[model samples]
Target chain A: MTEWHDAAAADALSDDEVMGLSIAGVPVALFRQEGAFFALHDLCSHGAARLSDGFVENGCVECPLHQGLVDIRSGAPCSAPITEPVRSYPVRVVGDRIEIALNR
Target chain B: MTAMPESEATYVVVGGGQAAAWIARTLRAEGFAGRLVLIGEEPHWPYERPALSKEFLRGTGSVEAITLLGAAQAGEAGIECWLGQRVTAVDRVARVVTTAGGRSVAYDTLFLATGGRARRLPGLDTVPAERVHTLRTLTESERLRGALGGAKHLLVLGGGWIGLEVAATARALGVAVTVVEAAPRLCARTMPPVVSGWLHALHEANGVRVLTGTGVAGVTGTADGIAVTLAGGGRLEADHLLLGIGIEPEVGLAAAMGLALDDGILVDAQGRTSDPRIFAAGDVARHPNAFAGASLRLESWANAQNQAIIAAKAATGGTAVYADIPWFWSDQYGVTVQMLGLPGLGTRAVARGTPEAGSGCWLMLDDTGIVAGAVAVNAARDLRVLRKLLEDGRAPLPDAWTDSATPVQRLPSRPNVGMD
Candidate 1:
């Protein structure tokens, strides 16, 4: 069964912005890029750091801890030192609410 | 020796570290379908050394997690890795490298990424072997981590990056730590005075006793442990001691090969060594940095990766010059310290954030108001913008550079010198 939970308000993040959110004890990073929203595991694959604290540019998020770059849309690591990719969560937007499917 | 015909290009990279791994992968990535072999002295696969002092030592990083290349990746890349094999001699005229195991391999092009080893202090040859430690590889880190797990106190013998990092990790693991430095401040050679003071205070605030301007005169085994005598007539006894002094470049192999050496193997802009068919990179390659006026060796992670790319591309017949400003970072006790560009002597620093607040940025500017470098502590986001500004060789307004209200992204961009 698909489990959907309200993450935040649709307008909480502007274009090219990101924030940290927790869903069911799992840390998640929400990013708004080009009028759409994407979600990824909040933790960096290389170190113990939050992905939301990273810089977002050119459709990728640079890890604050190690400067490892990860593609936001696909959660694939696009740079060296980071071989693993963060898990991506499905996102849905309805009116002013942004929801995420945990798919538990 | 049988003279094998060199039909396919066989590229061999010496040393199994970051530089070796990158060169092997890059050679394949650059469409070199020939044979690639990596020779390493260590038994294990190539792993990151940074985590050894920080996360791995603190029990947070695992052995498998720190590996740079796994079995699957190596197989996929078709790289023949000869781990634990030491390259004793290279027959340059014959284009063959002989290993300690009596095996010889021929290569059309060779890369000397031999890297370096930790420097040892004098008069400590008899300090009860297990009591002294110097971290350089994963095996050394593992031994130190194991020793720290049962040890009560750790005495770090230097105040440099590795010393401070190990001190921080020791503190986190509930081990009493003391950092002793001969200099008056922390990171005296690499960081500015403000940063040094900040780090001294940061270590103090975190319960690690930091002693500056104090040198370890001698070490003797005591009834309890080892007694370390200080220069100023002070004494400290700790269960274990770690020497975190700088490293000595692995130039013996290159020197034996009759390559040019000045502190390190001299390389040109394309990472070519003294010989046209041979190249060097990473800590072992000392080349003239465009930013720094003289030839110097960089042992940072950034240099290992970027320089390997330049050397690999050049070996594969591509023109890639290594001109990027050197950058490095150190993580200690939750604070991430980063430095971009060469903030050497004569560069003035302007502060942007409060050092006492545990977050700050320092813009290193030349006399002509050009951005020469930047150092940031817990300010990685702002560092991204500062790096761009520094690369552009544009100067930020004096007021704006130091103003806390000025977001780095909003800093006015200036026309890059020689670009427009």
Candidate 2:
């Protein structure tokens, strides 16, 4: 089953900003790059660092703890110190609210 | 100079730490289809060492969690790993390395990432081996973790990063911990006095008995516990003892090969050793560091990975220089402390945010008002921004830089006019 959860307001995050929130008890990071919003698991797959606290650049977020790069759109690890990929969610802006689809 | 055909040549990497692992992975990632061999003394594949003292000791992290390059990953990357095989000798003339198990592997190029081993205390010959411990390998960390489970008290020698991290982890496991350092303050060699004082206070607040300006005169093991005689004519008892003095670079093979050595295997900016065909990285190589303005053997995780990547690229005929600014981080008691650049070059320290509240950073500025270094505690985001600013030789005006009200990202910065 697919469940859609309202993450935040569409304008809550500016360009190149990441916001962390727990949707259905799962930590998710909402990133705004360019003009589109992408969502990925908030926790880093390699270490205990939060991906939301990382620096987003060139469509990837650099893990603040280790500088590992993770693609914000596909949630694939793009650099060393991180081999596994974080889960990505389907995000859509419904009116003024940002909604993320999570598999149950 | 002509480059060898990628598929015809063979590249060998010695050691199984993060550096060696990255070298193997990077060799394959850079489109090298040659025979890649990784030889390591330990049986296990390469894993990150930071969590061994922190999460792994606290029983929260698993071996899989810390495993950086696994067997399957190595296989996928076409890296043939010779685990549990110690490289006994390097025949520079023959272009081959011999293992203790009598296996010889020839290579067109070799990477020496033989990191280091934990420095052992001199006077612990009388103590039983099981009671006195030094954490360097996975097996040692596992043994220490097992011992801590039943231990009542842990006496950690040398209040360095490793010692303090283990102390913090032991405290989290409900074990009474005491740290004794011969230096005047904790992490005195790496951190400034203010940062060291903050760490001392943090440890004391967490119920850790920290003794500075003290040394262990002798150690004796008994049936039930271990006794440590202090240099100041005092004695202390603990269930276990961990020697966290430091690490001695594994320069045995490098020295035998007649490579230049000064504290470690001396390497150029590209990690090339005395011989152009041989390279060294990680804790074993004392390469010229642009940030410190000296040849330094950095033991941090960042340097291990980045330096290995650069060395691997250079070995494969790439022209990348290893000139990254030094960055290191340590997590203790839910607080993350990160150090960037060289703090030793700072003449003035400016505070950003409320450090007492456990969310701030200290910006170290040189005499010319340029940001020389930074120590951030739970403020990685600000440090990230500051790193870029530092790279660009930009500094925020001194007046508004220290104001906690102004956000670090919003702090306006101008190019350093005083510096050329």
Best by TM-score: 2
Recovered native contacts in candidate 2, as a fraction? Answer: 0.92
Please write out the lDDT profile of model 1 over residues A1-104, one tens digit for every residue: 88888999999998878999999888999999999999999999877789999889899998886778999998998876676898999999988999998773
- Candidate 1: residue B308 Cα off by (Å): 1.6
Per-residue lDDT of B1-420 in model 1, one digit per residue for the tens?
123433377889999998888888888878888888999999989877889998888777887887776677889999999999999999899999999999999888999999999988889866788888999999899899999999999999989999999999999999999999999999988876767888899999999999999987899877656789998897999999899888999999999999999999999988999899899999999988876667879999888988988899988778879887778999888887898876544257788886457688887666655566678888887887776666666556656877778778777666423221
lDDT of 2: 0.89
Candidate by candidate, in order, the iRMS in Å equals 1.4, 0.7
Give candidate 1 misplaced runs (Cα > 4 Å).
A1-4, B1-7, B344-347, B413-420
Question: How does each model score on lDDT?
Answer: 0.85, 0.89
Every model: Cα RMSD to truth: 3.3, 2.0
Which ten contiguous residues of candidate 1 chain B have the minimum total lDDT? B411-420
DockQ of candidate 2 is: 0.86
lDDT of 1: 0.85
Write model 2 residue lDDT over B23-72, tens digit each, in one string: 99898888889899999999988988998888887788888878878988
Which regions in candidate 2 have their CA more than 4 angstroms from the true location? A1-3, B1-4, B416-420
